[model samples]
Target chain A: MDFNFTPEEEAFRDEVRAFLDENLPENGTRDMEAVAEFQRRIREKRWVGFSWPKEIGGGGGSIMEQVILKEEMARRKAPALGACFMGLAWVAPALIEYGTEEQKQRFIPDILDGKYQWCTGYSEPGSGSDLASLQCRAVREGDEYIVNGQKIWTSIAMWSKWMILLVRTQTDVEAKHDGISCLLVEMESPGLTVRPIKNMAGGDMFAEVFFDDVRVPVENRLGEENQGWKVTVSALAHERSSISEVYGLTRSLERIKVLAKSCHRNGRPASEDPGFRSRFARADARIEAMRLNGMRFLTKQLRGEPLGSETSINKLHRAQLEIELGELALEIEGGLGVLVQGDSAVPDDGLWQRHALSWPEVVIGGGTPNIQKNIIAERVLGLPKD
Target chain B: MNFGFTEEQELLRAEVRKFLDQNCPLEEVRKLCETPEGFSRSLWERMAELGWVGLTISEEGGGVGLGWVDLVVVLEEVGRSLFPSPLLSTVLAAKAVDLNGTEAQKSRWLPGLADGSRIGAVAITGDEGRLDAAGIALEGRPDGDDFTLDGEKLLVMDAQNADILVVAFRTGSGEEDLSLAVVERSAKGLNIEPHRTMDLTRRMGRLHFDGVRVSADALLGSAGSAWAAIEHLQDCAAAAVCAEMVGAAEGALKLTTDFANQRVQFGQLIGRFQGVKHPLAEMFIDIESFKSLCYYAAWLLDECSPEAPLAVSRAKAYASESFARIGVDSVQLHGAVGYTWEYDIQLYLKRAKWARPAFGDAEHHYQRVAKLRGF
Candidate 1:
């Protein structure tokens, strides 16, 4: 029943808070430049992979400690380190779980040092949410495989140096889950091209990656051929676990509080209005609830309990709360909440307005709320599928 | 750092649930609602006999000296049964008297309250039933060996059955010049008007203290600093109410899922349809989210953190809105049968409707939270 941190954990949190206070930048800039600086600083401090094993050049912390670090960093409003993708979340875990000794030795240090960034190349144009139906082709020739296909929403493909990709190795298997293979494709390989896609957020955070007869050695394959479904599932599980829309919403709440205090409404502060106060309170409650849900998940992870379908529960709640917060921010600002980031005379960094405008992408990214609902129904509730 | 309940607490929860299932089922609640008292004295005695009445009170005063977590466990069970008793009022009164009352006051009242020989209710709301203590218009003046009380208190729960009434009055004109006085329910010029409420499971009454005379020793705490005690009482009550909402929400979700599995439509169980299935899933998610906050608030209360007030308000406001919505949606998903008086869905819905606006509506608590967060 205790929620307070132990004295030791509290001391550790204080240390981490102090470190973030001393290191994190405080100036405002465009997200791109901020992300670039964030990445560079992360590399300089060698703090890129907090959850990876020490043998892989990480901090060798437990999952709870990692959660604490994330919570503390977020509480301080520190920018996220750029390139938080397969390199840190997926490849690192997969390597620890299934990588050959040589593969771990080759990739772990480079990843931890930020020398190699990675993107997932799992979904093709036809795949989308029906991920097992991917049409990418790969054929074995001698000791190499030739890959040809296109991956949509290959996040940060232009910035990544490697990709953990899923491609079809066989087509006649009875089960669609089989007949797939996973490979680590080097970005420097010939016949590979990346083109950035402009998202609704007005950022080139995602790209389309095309592979045209690119050659990858047999040694580059992870796990086994026809086992790519399992690998992809593992990768997606990592992505879902890393989902902290709640953390982002917490930041939004803080920003909205500041906006309400400083922004004017009818010759008084916006916070003076009962309507704005009510909305702010609702947002605050949602944030607190989301934080506690995260703590429950973290506690379960620490106890080594199987998370399984409960991740869907977290995803659904977080996404809904985030959208609600966005809507509330707009309500708090009235017309000003709709102002764009670059709009002159806009207040409080326009973070809430930007969030309100860009929230649909969050709902669409990772997985849609409808899809999460289906997951909860089928997996968590054990209901019959449609 | 541990979030899981202790083995003892889990066992306590199981025992409480079992006791409530056997002693305070929905039929009993309906019967009590039909009665003029609006509560079951036998059930209250049984609960007290089981030592559930004085959970959070000090051991020297005949309580187990447990914390907020224990009270929440009991409250959740009470909510599951929609139990009609004086548990909420008595617990809150015990807390206020323990925290702020003088030794003489505690010695005079705690034993009787703990042993079920006496019942207590807090009267802090004014004529409009506003939550703000400053809104109270009750006036008290010291007259020799006694204080003359004259004001009307609205929406006092279980007042007809209470032996002691903790009345909040303005000793001076300022907002902070409020005081809590313990007045005997049989005091001269004390008038009680029983009223029917939307949720008949809990009793409500309006009390008018017309020049009621109380001894000088009846003042529970300092004359002008009862605001702190009243605030603490509000936080405790809010936390308990949130816990109750969590229980009701969980029950509604479970009942809806069971109905979804059993009820057939279009040649199959309607649970297979996305429309019904999605909302049910969302309700389950919302219930779980509410549980997290409720538990965190309970834990914060046990820790006695300065953040408890804000956390409790947040939990109460969120649970109030979420549970009410879920209750209504549960009935909608259950089809026409859910709306019938015989069906259990209405029971839950009624409890949720009453609970939402009891301590403070979602909007009221939300405003409290905004103030706490410096908005």
Candidate 2:
């Protein structure tokens, strides 16, 4: 297989590099005004959602070009393409795929413009890995759905202007995946309440959202009633670019390597310690494996093949690597590892300490390692289901 | 940037797989392993006719000029069948000659190797078993038009049958002074003793060189400058072994998966138990990941990328460990039958354990990676 980019692709990569060279702020420090200006410029260039369709104000770039754009941005350590995380990642894609014409016009532009954030409402207190068994209830009336349920682990719910809520519109179904429905509800709805939950790392990036008779207009329902599971599944499967995740881990590992050189163990730099060196090198090799695996996945997508359980492999690697690297960084720090952000003696403001404690977000959030293994077994390997 | 084989390469893979399935089935492998021949001459000749032995050699060298990526496909298939042959050792020797041999040397050796009229073996490690400068205790003392060679080399694969031995020896005191010399198996003062290795699919030999005089013309590259070529050869060998391990691991996983699907336990198929199924799943993941690494390493070497060395080391290190792990788990999932000599799974287990430290073990490659990463 050819690993070299085509000349045209190379030119596109050069163009991305040129754009970043001219516009990316020195040191990659972005204040509010600079961040706004940067987003505006990328949005103007249609690089923000570069893979989305041109008919929808996107760059309409090829998948390869999108990868180049992302690689260049990650190399320069530039700010994320848009301020909206879940919105840009999944919400807009779902909307474009299944939303009504009016709904797309209403939400797509704001989401692209980074005007506000959007959070998902898939995981309930009782329904996690078994997400299809969600019990959030929404009964439809004349032109509204009376939503009433609680959604735990609603990431960014406290700050998002809207929530892509998954509700149970019907219960009497043969399959658990059938009765679930997707609804777009405004955070400002009268009966909706968001109680922020502090994570183990002492951050409130997510919340437990309570829906008490929240009146969402029937028009806000995504796709057909009782067909929202299809909408959500298809949306999540929109474009599998877990390859982009590799750049982040690569950068993180680089930082840890630098720390290894500076941090001391047994009166010598930790990087010189045989044990630490082996760990660092092993982590490095594993990350490279993930990157190559991502390329394999990208190749499948490029060949017009729909990605399935293969993505879970990298998810598993990412989970394990994130935890391993975080712990290794703290171990390099020794006693100083226990210090937090505000502690005076903390190294790098105790970034490693928080990282060590914050692994559940990556390891346990999307799907646990066990779930990923099950998917690989039953789907990829064609083994009998347990 | 596609991480896949071309259509022609895929065809080559399918053809090799079919050939092995028909000609080198498990029974044949078992039979050959039992015989002193260790491998079938007819199968070797047929594979040579298929142009596999000299796959990466240039057309001028009397073989099809293909890249490492193409060779990787055939090697993977060979690995899948557990084909008892000297293809790997022969290819590695051919690679060394192709990389450094002069026109005269190429004309003298490559054609025989390319046509499979002659077998080749690479004697890298000595008694210490380290694949490095320290491993080559053999010393080749220059005397006029010849170099007198004297040392012992151990664990030389297919050495008993190899017509040509590519021997690494110390030409000077410095580590970088290590050189490689091509010596004939019929050399006057050389002895080749075959060892009954635990892995019967391939045979190992110990070579004793007692003042064996080799013409200076047989030096593959410049004297005292063979370390670089030797390292490159090691990388090539490691990557090739990784490809083989990937194939073997895939084979083991397939057998285990089928067994789990059919075998009944406690009134249910063993595959229905998460306890039995999850390990198989884990094996699948490891194989897939290792396969990706193998393909990437093969591509990097074919492209001659500067990162090829590190990539090869990564693939080798991972495969060396993961293949062994998959082998153990596959046998475990198969229960008692997997442990029997009559069963095929034990063969894979032995191959995995044998290959764990063949070119370089996991720890050695990890150390190499750490060095390459500037740690």
Candidate 3:
């Protein structure tokens, strides 16, 4: 029935918050210096892979503690760890669960100590939400697998040193989910190219990665042949439950609250209006709900209940909530909400309006709302497939 | 920081859901929709008997001391059945009183509310404004031992069945000079006029107090401070309403998915087509998102966070918009059959339309959110 942190958890939160206060770079920009400093902090404090097992050079904390850290970091309005989320949350977990001993030894410590950055090469132009339909080809060549394909919206590819890629290894298999296999590919290998994509958020966060006969050691294969779908699914499950969306929503709520108080309506403070009061109540409620939902999901994971299709529910809700919150900020700002970043007339921060504009990426990226719904129907409700 | 329910709460939810499934089925909703009063008094009493009505009341007040999350679970089931009762009004009124009322007032009103003997309704709106207690023009002049009340309250839900009406009034000339008073329906010079609304599943009325006399003790809480109490009650109620909307949205989504799987079009079940499936998928997503927001809002209320007002607004606004959109899409996916009154889709649509506008519409809440966030 309680929602407050225990004294120990609270103390841990304080400690983390204090550390962030001292170590977080003062530069507000998400520039290379900020990224480098963030990586350095991870290396200095070993906070990058808090969820990884102790054998992998991590603190081996509880999942709740990981969630707590994420929430606390977000509450302080700190930037992401910038240590390759794909490597830590996705690839590393998959490796722990299914990788060979050698693969784990080679990859885990490198990722944990921030020596390597990883990008996920799951989606292509033809296969986005329908990831099982990937057309990427990887064929065995002696002791190596020659990889050839293009991955769209591959985040941090330009910054990453390695990639956990899914490719079609056996073309004539019975089912799409069965024929694919996962491989670890070196980003600096010959014939590899990375072209950065400018996102609406005004960041070059994603890239189009091309692998033209890039030679990866066969020992880099993540699991058995024709089992890439399972690995991919497991990785996605980790991503969904990681409470990353909670961080984003928390930051958005804080930004919105500041906007509401400082914004004026007719001669009085906008916060004084009954309408404004009501809306403030709602935004706060949704963020709290998202936080609680994350906790519930974690509880379920701890209890060994199948995570199931409910993660889709969390992703879907968070995307729409973020959009609505962004849109609400714009509405409150009136014309200012729609102001571009460079517009001089805007006050406080032009980023609120920018946030409003960039809100749709959440809904469109990851798994689209439509795709998440199908997952809920087919997997959660067990509705008959047509 | 636990968000998952304890086994006891889960058991309670299961029990309530089972009871609603058996007794307050959709057929009962259909029958009640056609009846004069949208809700059944006998059923209300039965709920009171089962201690459902008193679930949120403190143990000191002759009731269970469950928190907001527990109430949300019960409300969700009530919503799933579309059960017509003053459950929402009674619970909200009880909450308002609990939060602000004097010991005497609590002792006088809570037992009846807990046991369903004295139904209550809140009158915070007039014809033009929506739940703005400040806009009330109701005047109350002090007499020897009582006050003479004069004003009208519009769109009071379930006022016909309520024995006591908690009316908001302006005691001073200032916009914030508002007060709440408990006026009995049987009082002289009082008028109750029931009106038909968009959703027939809930009842609404206008209450006119023309020189109605009430004792000084009739005030629910401190005169001007009633606004804060009312706002708190409204936020809590909004959370419950959003939870209900989430329930209805979920039901509508399931119904549409079932229809899409079974109904044939173009020599195939419509579910196979992206046109039909995509929208249904989107609706499912919207419903899930609404669920998370709704649940979080409820949890926030239980935690009593200072940020609760903002969260409640977001939850209601999102749920209202999502539920209305999902209701329309569900009907559209069902084709001609969904258009008919007998098809049950309209029932959900009507409920959503009613619930969405009850406390505040989506746009209204969004604007409020804008102001809170410094838009």
Candidate 4:
């Protein structure tokens, strides 16, 4: 297979590089003014939602071009594509795919413009991995749906203005996956409350959101009632398309290399220690494998084949890799690794320490490793279900 | 940026798979294992006629000039079938000659090796069985228009079946002062003794080079300068071995998975139990990931990328451990019958045990990876 891109694709890559050169500062310098200006320029070029259909105010770029754009941006360590993280990531895709024309008109522009943040409302205390068995209830009124639910691990919920929520509209059904409905609920809805949760990393990025008979317009319902499962599944599908997470992982690897060269163990650079060196090399190998796996998935997508449980392979790798990389870096730093960000003795500003503690966000969120393993076993391998 | 094989490569894989399925089944391999050479000469000629042996040889060398990507496709199937042949050793010998042989030397050796009219084997490791400069203690003393070879080469693959041997020798004291000498197996003063191996699908031999003399022209490259070529050959071999390991592991997993799907315990298919199924899933994941590494390593070698050495070690190091693990798990999942000689699973486990250490064991490659990555 040809690993080299076509000349035309190379030209697009060149264009992206030139654009980044002009707008993005060297050494990954960032300030609010520069970041805002860069976003504006990229949005003007319609590169924000580069792969989304053009009819929806997206760049409508080819998948390959989108990859190039992302590669260039990531190589330069630019800020993420849009300011509204979850909104631009999945919410907009779901809205575009399942939102009513009126709903699209109301929310799509706001998402594209990064006007406000959106958080997911999927998991609950009882519904972490077995998500479809969620017990959150929504009862349809005359023209609105009254929602009552508690969503846990709602990332960025405290800062988000809205939530893409899943609620059970019918209690009795043939299967647990049936009777679920998706709603675009305002965080300001009368009975809704968001309490930020302090994770082990001592960060408040995730929150527990509660709803007590919150009123949501029936029009805000995404897709048909009892079809939110389909909408949620499709929305998550969009998340797998780019495989850009590999770039982030690769960048982390480069940082680890630098830290290894600087940090000492046994009065020599840790990079020279047999145990540390082998561990780092193994990390490098695993990351390369993950990157190649991502490329394989991308190849399937480019061939017009839909990716399914195969994405779980990389997801499983990424889950382990995140922890592996962080731990490796921490071990290289020796005792100083225990120090947090503000400690003067801390290495890499305690980035690895934070990273080492951030495994739950990746390892447990979306789906746990066990869940991914089960999916791979049953769905991909054709093994009998557990 | 496509991470897929070309149509021709896929076709070659399928063709080899079909040919092996029909002509060189496990029973055939088992039968061949009982032979003196542990090789199937008829199957080797058939594969050669199909242009399998000369896939990586340039067209000018009297064979189809292709890349490692194409050769690996056939090699993987050969591995899957547990085919008993000297194809890998022959390819490695041919590679040594092609990479460092002079025009005259190339003309003297490549065509025969390419056409499978002559078999070849590599003698790199000595008594230590180490695949490094330290391992090549076979001394070669400079003489008038010739070099005198002395020392023992152990674990020489296909040595009994090879017409010629590419022997790595220490021409000087420096670690990098290693050179390759291509000597005919019939050279005077050379003794070949076959060694029994755990994996009977292939043969290994010990070569006692008692003052075996070869002309200066027999040297593949300049004296004390073959270290790089040797490393390159090892990378090619490692990458190829990784492909084979992936194939062999996949085969074992497939057999075990099928068994799980069919066998019942407690009135339910064993595959329905998480205990059985989860290990199967883990095996599948390892195979898939290792396959990616293997192919990527092949691609890197094909392009002669700077990353080829590291990638090769990565693929080898990872596959070496995982393939053995898969072999063990496959047997474990098969239950009592898995350990029986009557069962085919034993073939793969044996293959894995032998192949894991063939082209630098896991520990060696891991350390190589560290060195290459500038650690």
Among these predictions, the greatest lDDT belongs to: 2
Q: Deviation in angstroms for A69 in model 1? A: 2.7
**Top DockQ prediction, candidate number:** 2
Task: Quote the lDDT for B315 in model 2.
Answer: 90
Model 3 regions lying over 4 Å from their true place: A28-41, A77-85, A124-126, A141-161, A187-216, A235-289, A302-304, A313-365, A381-386, B96-101, B175-177, B222-225, B290-306
Highest TM-score model number: 2
Per-residue accuracy of model 3 over A266-343 as CA lDDT, tens digit each? 866555666656655565545555565666677677676777777676676677777777776777777566567677
The residue-by-residue lDDT of candidate 1 on B177-280, one tens digit each, is: 88888888889999998877777777878888899997878887767788877777777778888888888887788788889888998999888999998988
Model 2, B114-203: lDDT tens digits are 999999999866565687776677888889867899878889989999999998898777778788889998899999999878889989
Name the 10 consecutive residues with the lowest summed lDDT in model 3 chain B.
Answer: B125-134
Task: Tell me how each candidate scores on DockQ against the true complex.
Answer: 0.62, 0.75, 0.32, 0.73
Candidate 1 ranges with C-alpha deviation above 4 Å: A14-47, A76-84, A139-148, A172-175, A188-191, A211-215, A233-248, A311-314, A321-343, A348-353
The stretch of ten residues in a row with the least summed lDDT in candidate 2 chain A is A232-241
Instruction: State the TM-score of the second chain for every model.
Output: 0.96, 0.98, 0.95, 0.98
Q: What is the C-alpha lDDT of each candidate?
A: 0.79, 0.87, 0.76, 0.86
Better candidate number, 1 or 2, judged by lDDT: 2
Residue pairs clashing, model 4: none
Local lDDT at B363 for model 4: 78
Please give, for residues B220-311, the per-residue lDDT of candidate 3 as tens digits. 77665667766777788788888788777877877787888788878887777767866776676566656766777777787888878777
Candidate 3 versus the native: TM-score? 0.85
Assess every candidate by TM-score.
Answer: 0.91, 0.97, 0.85, 0.96
Q: Give lDDT tens digits, candidate 4, residues A173-285.
A: 99899999999999999999999999998889999998998999998999999989888755323335335777888888878889989999989888888897777777777
Docking class of 3: acceptable
